[model samples]
Target: MALVPMETALQRLLEDVGPLDGESVPLKDAYDRVLAESIVALRTQPPFDASAMDGYAMQGADAQTTDGELAVIGEVAAGSTFSGSVEAGQCVRIFTGAPLPAGTDTVVIQENVDRPADGVIRLREPTAAGRNVRRAGLDFTTGDLLVEKGHLMRASALSLAASANHARLKVVKRPLVAIIATGDELCLPGSELGPGQIISSNSYGIAAAARAVGADVLDLGIAPDREDAISALVKQAVAAGADVIVTSGGASVGDHDLVHKVLTREGMTLDFWRIAMRPGKPLMFGRMDNIRCLGLPGNPVASLVCSQLFLKPLLARLGGRTFHQDIRTATLGAPVSANDHRQDYVRAAIEERDGQLIATPFGVQDSSMLRTMAASGGLVIRAPFQPASEIGDPCQLMMIG
Candidate 1:
């Protein structure tokens, strides 16, 4: 079968992904969750026209001259209301957030005023109407949509909603991603390993990627390369209410590769297998009972790259958050060879000189190596079957964080 193009595979994967179900959560826990619906203000901010400064609230005309003196009819602090009207040359001593008494149109800050006697203060600076005042609904009025649907609840957004009188918010449910590692030659990390065996490491990276997008993960542990063993774990992930199940290793054409067959036997309708990309050729995508099942190659680098290219965006979309690759153009600092049928994602170190991005790929391009991939800040994108290029040639790159 012809390998699927990277863009086409992504499009197909996204088409079957639906936004997560909605749930109501307390405002405190709603931060970083995607809003499921628009949040309207429950009540007007400030509730009434109030003083914004801790000083005398009086008519602007009376506070224009430094010699102006006004008898403080009464004092109003925050949460206190004064109903009596203040006439010309008479001011009310009001604290910040206090409701502006009737007939008060301006405020003179305490620093700009002088008091020579009890309840008697003189203006030392000019004040203007509406100065140091927060009018009713200045921040948000009743029935006003403060946070729109599909918005990722950032710190500022969450605080804004809370200030608008929202004690709770409706947010999309976080999808549960289940990760399973397959290989008889794998052992859990921190355990003593025998010859021909290695520590299973795919779940940790896959789960972290899912969590970066706010998705929950149910790590199903290791499933050795046995039909019954793999099937049992698949059933376990489904029973745990996982929205997506991912298996790393056993995806290639080797005799030990059994992920594709296992998923199909478990009722997964195969969408596509084998993407046209270096370090991730054996990547497989499918669905089973509406739950996504991704089969990623055993190579550690392949698994991580697939998680970044496919898993992150899939989870982000379902969580109602926007996702995009940070692709940029750069000049090659070293010569590069031609590609074959698969597109190349050469791990490279990037630097900027005079604001020009320069990409330098490591000497070795082995997909199984992790040391070089870790030192890389981005991947230099090379199209499939492209010709060789010399140093200083322009190319596109996708930044990784």
Candidate 2:
């Protein structure tokens, strides 16, 4: 099969993907979840005209000037109301958030009133009608939409929803991705490695990538380089109702590569097998019914780069969130050789100098070197068949940091 262009592969992978079904969750647990339904106000904010400050509430005309003394008819605090109305030349001692007594149109802040006697106060400043008062439905009226669908629940959204009297929220279900590592030579970290064995590290990075896009992860541990071993894990992922199954290693055409054959045998329809990109050329994508199956390259750096390039966006879409790679323009800090036919994603150190971004690629960009990938802040993109470039040349970068 021919290698697929990077753009073509991405388009095919995300062609029909969409947000999952909605599930109701408590408001406390809704933070960072995408809303499946717009949040509507169940009750009006400041359901009644209320005081916005600690002051004396009276008719605005009653305290137009500082000379007149008004009799304090009663006192009202937040959560309590005065049963009687304020007559002419009368005021109520009201605290912040207290409901305005009948016949009162304004509040003279305590700072602007002087209490000459227990029942009399003289205004130092004139408060206009509705001044220091929160009118009924001041923030939002009942049935008004406060947050739109597809919005992410952040601190402000949660607070607004709670103020609108919402105890529960409808949010898109977070996508679940089941990950499997396949290779006889791969072992868990901290294991006493047999000769030629290496630590299985891809699943950790892949899981982190999945979570950063709001997808829940299920690691199925390491599967040996055998079809039956891989098939069992694949079936487990299906049984667990995972929306996506990510398999690390076994994507290439080598004899030990069994992921493609096993997934196809398990009823997955191969969407694509190889990509026209450096390090991640063996990338595989398929579908088994509703589940998306992605086979990433075995090399550690390739696995992580592919995860950043592909898995994040897929999971973000499934979780009802928007995602875009942090690609930017930068000048090369050093000279770079010409690229091959395949597109290149060179790991580089990114720094800003004199308001311009500079990307200096590492000397060796071998796919197997995880240390270089970790140390690099971004990937400098080189299009296919681009000529050799010199220092200060303009280039596009996909920022990772």
Candidate 3:
């Protein structure tokens, strides 16, 4: 019976929630997945001291002078090793990635050496000891931690894991969200509209929002306003192993609102219903066993706004990621009259003037108008029972675009 505060509802929705179970996937398919466990290097990088450039490997002391000369003993290319050791006055032609000869401590680049004869080479410039040489385990050694748990596997992380000899990775399982739209007057998009009927668009937007937060979505399509039809889909969502079930419409107290009755019968314990926010006051949240159920309003704008405000964060938490709202401070560009019992989230057009953000709310903010919601850059928050405000007053803003 009472409207729940926005903050309290969010806290309840996320209470005790955490990352899902881990699943092993191939390295190629692990991109963008969160690591479930830390990755340790199995083998050392540059297992042996190797050459970093095409050069001649010899003792550093032997090539200290510009006139230094040494007899070419052997040639070592990448993926090949020199059997003989380098002795004084002797050098080996070594290509990039070739292991350093046993007795060599440095590599004189080819540009700094001139071939005086078929086997004799003269040094034009001296190279430092260990120059142009990659020491063993230069990048990482065995047992080194390559990546930590909960890290997102980006391109760089994937490459690092591969270099650490990891063929597969343990990643967090993406949370699955099952969506059901309930209404007698709702039809899928591109369908011929009957009298008093409208196209079903909330599920599409809700599904997209769910996916943007690392959730896998299963759209169960529209269910007519009947207890059996709604309950059947709810069972399907549970059978499909959905972590969360989202229902649009049938949440209010109207005669046709049957979601509450069916969900309670299906073992969902109502946590809270009705938020102290405009456009989305009819929001509902509950739980059945391990599955979370969120009943959103029927209006398109309300559905989208509630998704951005609540659903994204809940899904992100379940997927082993953190989500933060982009809230900022701005000045109201136009005067606004405000005084109400419910908090208002007035969608506004944002612009930057003289390095300050200016938020101008659209003239009409009907919950059914989707075009205005799409054109808004952010929402200007107004507290309940607040006084009328003039232009240039300070306001809190939540950026949506």
Candidate 4:
């Protein structure tokens, strides 16, 4: 089969995926969830004219002059209203958020007034009308849009929704991913190792990647390199209603590579296999009805690279969230020789010097080394069939976390 380009593979994977159904959740539980509908203000903010500062509410004409004197008739705090109206020579003592007294158009800050006697105060400074007063609907009016659809709920967004009188919100359902690991030589972590046995580590990284994009993961444990064992887990994934099925190992043409055979036997229609990228050239993608199946390479670094390049975007689209690769331009810190049929994603350390980003690739480009992959900050992207380059050459990098 001809190798598919990386862009073509990604475009095919995200062709028909979309957000799942909406579910109603409490405002407290809606954090980090994608909004399914626009939120409208239920009631006007500040429902009525209120005081913005601790001051005395009175008629503007009565407090305009520094020599004015007024009698304080009543006091109003937050959540309380004054029943009596303010006349020319009368004022009401009001605190922040308290409703302005009837017939009062201004609030004179307490600092600008002096109390000469009980219930009597003299203005020390001229006060302007409508000063320190929050008019009705100052933040939002009734029936106004507070938050738009497809927005991710953050701390501020949740607080704003609550202030808009929304106790519950409609959010898109999180996409579910089922992961299966297959290898005869693989054993669970912390197990006594036999000859030619290694711990299964791909599922852990794959699950973490899926959850980082807000997708729920179901780990199906390890399956031996047998067609029946792999097929059983695939059926279970379908029964559990997984939106995507990710399988690690057994994707190449080796004798033990049984994922492709089992998935095809289970009625999967293959989309493309064997991409043109280095380290992850054996990657596979297909669909078994509504469930999307992704076959990843056995090498640790290859699997992770494929996940960062392909799986993250697919899951983000299915979860109704936006995603874009953090690709940046940088200069090579050392000389590099290139010319190959496959695209390369060389793991490198990035540093900034004199406002220029420098990418220094590791000595080895092995796909099975997970420690080097972890220590690297990003991958320097190299196009196919490029000429050899010297030091300080311009390069593009994809940042990884």
Candidate 5:
């Protein structure tokens, strides 16, 4: 079979995938969720003209001249309304947020006024109309669109939604991913390793990647190199309503590789296998009914690289979120050899020096070297069939972390 190119594999993996159905959630629980529908204001903000400062409300005409003395007819605070109207030489002492008096069009701040006698105040400075007053509907009017659909809710968005009188919000449902690790030579972390047994570490990184794209994860634990064990876990994933099922290892043609056989027997229509990429050439993708399945390589670095390249984007689309690769151009800090038929993603350390990005690839790029992959700052992309290059050559880099 011809190896699928990376771009073609990604396109097929994300084909026709869309956000899940909407569900209502309380305002406090809506943070970081994608809005399913646009939020419209139910009531206008500052429904009535109100004071913006602690001051005296009076007719604008009466405060146009300096040394203007006006009798305090009454007082009003926040949530309180003045009963009588204000006339010339008459004012109402008002606090912030109090409704403007019926006949008053301006407020002289307390700092700019003087209380010379009881029930009487003098304007120390001339004031203009509408000063220190918030007009009706100043922030937003009723029926105004405040937040559009597909927007990710943040702190400001939640506050705006609350101010728009929305106690609950319709948000896209988070995608659920089920992860399974396969192999008889694998054991959980912190366990005494028997002969030929290594700790299973890919699930942790894969789960974190899924969550970074807003997908929930269910770790199905380790499955021995047996068809029955693997098949049982696959069935459990389906019964758990997983939107995507991710399996680590057992994707190649080796004797112990049973993921491919089990998935096909379970009625998964194989989409593609063996991508034209280094380190992760044995990658596989398929679908079973409504659930998508991905078979990743056993090597730790290969699994993580494939997850960042493919799984993240697929989950982002299914969760109604946007994802973009942080690709950058950089100069190679060391010489590199020519590429083969497979595209290469060489792990490297990247630094910014003298206004230019310098990428230095590690000496050994073994896919099983998890420490090197963890320390890598980025991946230097090498196109297939490319010629050999030397230091200072321009290259494309995909930033990690």
Candidate 6:
């Protein structure tokens, strides 16, 4: 079968998967969550006109005289308000954040005045009118939009919401992904493996990939290459309320590839059965009763690459978060062959030599080689049907898991 184009597969998944419902969480716990509704401030900041400095609140005109002396009638600290009016030559000692007392239109800094034995201070510098006062609602007015819906709450955003008198926030729910591994040749980690069996390793890598994008994963363990077993696991995944079900191995056309048959039997409408991507050709995608299903190939590297290409974005959409791969342009370190139908994602180690990104492809591009994939920091992309290129030629690359 022909492979599905990259654009078509992404569009199909986005069009079919709906975002999960919103839930209310405490303001302190809302960090990194996407907001589901706009947040309006319940009260104005600097609720009352307040002083912004430690100074003596005085009338500008009263300090213009030769002596510049004014009596400190009262002391006002933060949260304290003075109702009495300031007479022509009277002043009040106020701390920072204290409400500017009634009848005081200006302030003279304590450093600029002489606090003598008598309760009086002199203006060492010329009085500047209305210089140290924070006007009412200086930060934000009541009923103003502090944050909008779909905004991802970060440290600053959460603080702003709390300052707006909100104790809780409405946020999108996290997506739960169910993972199932299939193959009779698979054995659990740390088990005594028979000569023919390999460790069931794909689920761990897939689970980490899912978590890196904020989706929760439920590992369903390994199943034999039997239609009954695969079908039962698919049904369990559906009943377990997984927003996405990722099945590793058994996704291709071999006789033991029971994933495709079981998913279809469980009502999955196959959107696409394959993709034009190397090391990951059997990348199947579909939906079953609102739950997304991704049938990933058995090869370890293929499964991981498919997760980065497809699974991340799918989970991001469900969780109401934005996701993008870190793709960059770089010059090849050595000559490479090309001219294949599948677009290749060659494992590579990227480096910077005098600020230029140099991508060196690994010697072996086999799908089952995990050591090379581990050593690689990224993938150098090679287009389909392109001729072999020499060193220093430009290529595109995407950062990996």
Q: Give the top-scoring candidate (TM-score).
A: 2
Question: Which pairs clash in the backbone of model 6?
Answer: none
- State each model's CA lDDT, in order: 0.90, 0.94, 0.94, 0.93, 0.94, 0.87
Which ten contiguous residues of candidate 1 have the minimum total lDDT? Answer: 60-69
Candidate 3 Cα misplacement greater than 4 A, ranges: none
The ten-residue window of minimal lDDT in model 5 covers 60-69
TM per candidate comes to 0.96, 0.99, 0.96, 0.97, 0.97, 0.92
Error of 5 at 253 (Å): 1.1
Across 82-133, the per-residue lDDT of candidate 3 in tens digits comes to: 9988998999999999999899989999999988789999998777777899
Worst 10 residues of 3 by lDDT: 60-69
For candidate 3, the per-residue lDDT at 346 reads 94
**Candidate number with greatest lDDT:** 2
What TM-score number comes out for model 5?
A: 0.97
Which digits, one per residue and each the tens of the lDDT, describe model 6 over residues 17-85? 656899999898788888888899998997988888898887767655536577889999998888788
In candidate 6, position 226 carries an lDDT of 90
* lDDT-better candidate, 3 vs 6: 3
lDDT of 5: 0.94
Error of 2 at 401 (Å): 0.5
Off by over 4 Å in 1: 65-68
For 1-401, candidate 2 gives per-residue lDDT tens digits of 99999999999999999999999999999999999999999999989999999999999887677777999989999999999988989999999999999999899999998888889999887777778899999999999999999999999999999999999999999999999999999989999999999999999999999999999999999999989999999999999999999999999989999999999999999999999999899999999999999999999999999999899999999999999999999999989999988999999998999999999999999999998899898999999999999999999999998
Q: Tens-digit lDDT track for model 1 on 176-245?
A: 9999999999999898989999988778889999999999999889999898999999999899888899
Candidate 1 lDDT score relative to the true structure: 0.90
> Tens digits of per-residue lDDT for model 5 on 1-401?
99999889999999999999899999999999999999999999989999999999999887787765799999999988988888889999999999999999899999988888999888788989878899999999999999999999999999999998999999999999999999999999999999999999999999999999889999999999999999999999999999999999999989999999999999899999999998899999999998999999999999999999999999999989999999999999988899999999999988899999999989899999999898899999999988988999999999995
